[model samples]
Structures are given as structure tokens and as C-alpha cells.
Target: MSSRFRHAALVGKYQARGIQGPLEEIAQFLVRQGLDVSLERDTALNTGITDYNALTHAEMGRECDIAIVVGGDGTMLGSARQLAQFGLPLVGINQGRLGFITDVPIGHFADALAPMIAGDYEEERRTMLEGGVWRDERLIFDGFGVNDVVVSRGPTSSMIELKVTIGDEFVGNFRADGLIVASPTGSTAYALSAGGPILHPGIAAWVMAPIAPHDLSNRPIVLPDVGRISIEVAQGRDASVNFDMQGMASLLPGDRITVARSSHQVRFLHPLGWSYYATLRRKLHWNTGV
Candidate 1:
């Protein structure tokens, strides 16, 4: 069978001596296979590979048919946000400590590259959340969260109040350290640490977890990923709504944010024999009941 992807781009942690070997290996592998290959600017500079073409992040997204991300999940998260709009497919080679989204092992990935290029792989379409904040009818914060969108206190180090509504239904006024609206992809992230359930990535759902609620009775809830989630913060103190801990926007009393499933989704490619259960077992230590 012929290769499914022609132009490929390599994006990795922007450091030398760390990913240089694997980066150069994959670049040369694709080159010998006759598939066009390029590198993200920092990846090229850090790896000291002068022969292949280099593209800026934007250029890479617009140009490449596939992006082979060679870092931890953080690298993939950043890339996913940038390329999700372009609808680019990402294949990860785990160089991170915890490989949730970045699953493919380094040595194993090198071997699978050829077959993956030949269209022998599985594609996972993961859902994303799009959120925007409104201040007196003016839009302020606009961004996408792959994991969770949080509304919480800033430098004050005290609890804040948030009035929440889910699809016209009033949930409650939450008084807590913070609140996290986690996508199923986010269930394993902050939401999980906050005592929230892990919804399977394939499931279409969101989890609303309160971070240290003043009332123990206030609990996390899983809701369908439909309609809009509205959160209005109470006034008199400093607060912000954080997106993936990557972006944040200040909020005032009565300012609100509405989060909904984005129309766009991120496509992740895995080599033929990928298993989510295995990943969870390895990452979370499933069987060792200590």
C-alpha cells in the first residue's frame, strides 16, 4: 500500500541533546521513504538539523499533512490548540514522564512510523471545549480548553462564589476554592485530582468538579456535552477563569462565561494496537491496591 501522508512536520520539546537523536532519525526515515518532511522552527534549531526545511508554528499547521509531536503531553496539548483549527492530525512519541495523550514509546514509534505512513493505524477524534467570557455584553476571553476550564480565586487565597447554570437549568451557587468543567479528555487531569470520576475519552460528557467546596454536600456531576454552561462569579474579590492553566482572564462581579463543545475536534493517530485501558493501568497504577 502507498503512504497515506506525503508532507510531514516534526514538533518537539524545544531543547537540544534531548530529542536530537530521535528527531533526526524520524526525519531521515521519512526522507528515505520518499515522503516530504519538515520541522517546526524550534525543533530544527534545537536539533541542529540544517538540511531539512523549517516552518514556523503557523506555517507548519497550514502546510503539513501530519504533525509528529515528540515530547510530553504538554507539547501535544500546545500543538493541539494551535492546529485544531487547521484540522491537522497529530501522532505522538512519548518523551514525557506521563504519556496520556503522548502514548507511542520512542523505540516502538520509530518502527511503527513506516506502517503508520502506509495508512495502518487508528484515528481518535477527541472533543474540545470552546469558552468565551462576557463583561457587560462585551466578549473578553476566548480560547479552547482540551482538558478543563476553571473559574476560581486569584491572589486572595480565599474561596469565591460562582452561580452556575447548565442548559437553562440552575445547578447551584458554588462556594469553593475553584470549579472545574472538565471534558472527558480532562477527566484524568485536574478533575480527577479533585475527586471527580474518570469518564472514558470516547464518551460525550463533561464533569463539573468543585475544588474544596465549603459544603461537603456540594459534589461533582457529569453532564452531557450539549447546550451551554454558564458561570457567573460574585463580586467583591479578585477571580479569574483559567483555561488548561495555559490562559486566564480576569473577572468582576456578575461577569459570566459560557462554555460549549467546539465544532472542531482534534484527531490523534495511534499505531495499530492501542489500548486506553492499558494506558490508564500504566499511568494510574490500576491493580496495585496499596
Candidate 2:
């Protein structure tokens, strides 16, 4: 379905390592297009663009017809969880090293946006995972992650032993630095670093990879999105559950966390001429030497 509002919401991290310059340019360019632009309050204040409307991250999803993110994939992933269920399509401008989600570069920002504004873009639906933490039968934290939910030992702790079960079947006990339950969109992030396979974004599966496992036989495993995953800290000095690197909750010696496919999905806007493989090649320096 087409959008109903002409207004667009702008979200980004101008404070990222090397992003301020391009962010300023994009913000100014959006204003020059005669479009009604909305910005996060802090961003609006930092950039000194007072005339624009201010909205919280989630509120922006409700107010704007489309949302534009001006940072790298991490920034986009964070914003996507907040805006995904709103059914607002996201346009990401690459301002960091790996532009997986933010595929549009600074040079082509204008060209890409013009067509997008006119509704000439493709929408790709990406999966998300929802997790909940329980302690003493009390619900502690519940949230969704676009990428992965990681359960790891805290600082100064040895490797953790975690018991994993899927659909009432015992998976196995994992003895590792941590465990990563990643969506297809996240296979290239921490999971890839731990030797997990890169999953195509359109795939409807998740990967469970044990980080720095004590046993080499514990390899990464792919699971269908329909099943439920239960992970308990069978034994550990100290451990924690992290959601997309944003939210964290403490895990005592015997805490268990359950992860399942979220009913909500994130929609990404891919303007004409954008290619995911091209992004991988560029970011990874695949052909730099040749």
C-alpha cells in the first residue's frame, strides 16, 4: 500500500565516530526539498534546525509517512525495531564502514531519495526476534531485536555453561564465552565473526552460534523461525542477556531466557539500483587487491 502522509521522519546518530559531516548535509538537503521533515529532539538541537518538528524515536514512526536513517547498519537496526511495526518504510543512508542496511552512499543520496519520495522503491520485509527474561517467576525484561539476542558471561567470569532446548527437545549444553541467537539480517554481524554462515536477508531462519566454545564439535546451527528457543544459564559465575547490544538484563546462576520469532517485521526501502551483494563486496574489500 502507498503512504498517506507527505511528511518524513529523520533518525540518525550524528555523534557516531565519523558521521557528523554527512548527516548535516543530508538534513539540510531534506529541508531544501520542500518536504515537511521531523527530527529527533536531540538531533534537531544538535544540528540547530529549529523549524523542524521533534518526535521521539517511536513517535516518529507514528507521525511520518517514511523514515530516513543517516548512519550505518547498527543505527538502522536500532531504529527499525522501534519503527518496524508502524508499517513505515525506512530509507538508510550509509555513513559508516559497513553499509549493509544503509546501502545508499553520500554521493547518491539525492538521486536515490528523489525516486523513493515518488514511491519508486522496493520494500523488503526483514524478520525480528522477541525475547523475555524471567526471574523467580517475575517478568523482568521483554523486548524485540532486529539482529540477535546474545547471552554471555559478564566481565571477569570464566566460560559459561548454558542448556539449550528447542520445541521440548534438548539441543545440548553449550560451554562457551557466549551464545548468539541471530536473525538472518544479523548473520553478518557478531555471528559472522564467530564463523557463522552469512544468511540471505530473505531467508526465514535463525542461526545459533556458540562464541569461543570450549568444544570444537559445537558448530553453528540453523533453525526454522517457527520454533521456540529456551536457553538457561545452567552454570556460570556471572552472565547477562543482551538484546541487540541495546538492552541488557542480569542473569543469575540459574536464569533462563526464551526467544521466539516476533510477530512484528521490519520493512526496508531499497531504491532502484541498490544491491546487497555489492554492499558486501564494498564493505569487506573483497576485490581490493585485484
Candidate 3:
């Protein structure tokens, strides 16, 4: 039987060591499956693989039916942010420590992906956050966040002060090492480390977790995604704001970072019988009870 994905685009973490082997293997596997394969520009350049066509992100967006990303969650996050705009469905191959997004094991890629390429897979949609920084009421930087947007203190020992507001209402003035504005997809990331609640992907909410606040009373809060979240740097020597992997440092006072729901959502293809709870159990070691 022929696969629905005739043309596949492969993306990888080119900076990581020992990635060329897997890239070559996957490319060969895809080609053997009777599909035309293209390597992402940088992935091809860095890996020095010239057997297949090298395409830019824009070209892949226009040409390929689906993208197979090989890396950890960080790599998937970066690719998802860039490819989400094109409505491209993605399949992730785990190469990092934690395979939250990259659920497919490197050894089991052929087993899991063979069926998926033939249109026998579960489809999942994940929402993204899109917003920007406002300096003196002027928009400066804007980007998408597949996980979360964070505002934290710089190298100085002093904590940052952030005035939080949800839409028209003022939340509070928090003094902490930093503040995390996370989507449901990010609940298990940095937010979880900061004591934020784990929100299911089906939930349309955001988690606001403060990084080590001065007052213990300030706790992690889950809010609806309907309103825009604004975090203004009230007081801090040097602060920074990060939208997932992209960020701007050395933010001055009065720099407002506004976040809201993005119109585009990432589409992921998982092997048949895949479950969010099952993923949580395996990844979090929930089933390894004593």
C-alpha cells in the first residue's frame, strides 16, 4: 500500500553531536518506503548529506505533506513554532533525554512511523501562544510560544518585580526570580519545576507560576486563555523575556510582555493507540511505584 505522505521533510538538531547518523538512517528509511525525502536546509548543510533535496522552511511548507522532526522536545518546540504557521503535520523522533513531544524512540522509528505514514495514526492539535514586548506603548518584539513565555531576572542577585494583569483586571505585583506564563502544553516543563499544576492538553487554560517569590502566599495560578496576559517589569536591575526558545534580554523597566492565544495550532501525528495519560505515565515514571 502506498503512503499518504508522498514527500517528507526531515528536520533535526544540527548542533547536536552524533545526529548525522540518525538523520542519514531516517532519510534512507523514508526513501525506501517509496517516498521522496527532503532535508531541511540547515540539517542538510550541517550534516553534509547531499543524496536528497535540500529545502528551506518555506519550501518545505509549500511542498511537503508532513514533516518528521528528529530531536528532543526542544528541537520539536523550535520546529513546531516555525512550521505551525504552514499547517504542517509533524512526527517527532526522540533523540533527547525527555521525549515528551518526541515520543517515538529512535530504535522503534520504523515500527511506529510505517503505519503513521500510511494514514493510520492519531491526530492531535496543540495550541500556541503569540504575543510581544511593548516598550513605551510601542510594540518591539513579537513571536509565538508553543510552550510558555517567561520573564526572569538577569545575572544580578536581586529578584525581579513584575506587575501582572489579566486583560482589564490587575492580578498582583510579584517579586521573584522570574515568572512563567505557560500554556497547557508547557505545564510539565519549567512550570512544573516551579510547582505549577499539571494542566491537561485538552484544557484551554494557562499556568502562571512564579519562580521563588519573596512572599510565600503567592502561588501558581491557572487562568483562562480568553484574556491577554500582561507582565510589566515593575522593578529589577536587568530582566529578560523568553517566548519558548526565542527571547530578548536586558529588558528595561516599563517593558510590558503581552501574551494571548495564537490563531494557529500545531498538528501532530502519533502512532495508533497513543494516549496522553499513557505518555504521562511512561515519561513521568508514574507506573514505577515501589
Candidate 2, residue 65: CA error in Å? 0.8
Candidate 2 lDDT over 152-249, as tens digits, reads 98889999999999989998999999999999988989999989998988889999999999999999998998878999888897688887887664
Instruction: Give me the runs in candidate 2 sitting further than 4 Å from their true place.
Output: 1-5, 17-24, 288-290
Q: Write the per-residue lDDT of candidate 3 for residues 60-84, one digit (tens) a residue.
A: 9999999999999999999999899
- Local distance difference test values of all predictions, in order: 0.87, 0.84, 0.93
Q: Which candidate number would show the highest TM-score if scored against the true structure? A: 3
Supply candidate 1's per-residue lDDT for 49: 79
Identify the superior model by TM-score, candidate 1 or candidate 3: 3
In candidate 1, what are the lDDT values of residues 1-290, reduced to their tens digit?
33489899989887524678788888888888778999988878777877889998789878888999998887888888888888889999888889899998887776878888878888889999999899999998888988889988877657888999988898889899889999988899999999999999889999999999999999999999999999998743678887787766467888998999999899999888888898899899986885
RMSD of 2: 2.1
Judged by lDDT, which candidate is best? 3
* Comparing 2 and 3 on TM-score, the stronger one: 3
lDDT against true structure, model 3 = 0.93
* Off by more than 4 A, model 1: 1-3, 15-17, 45-48
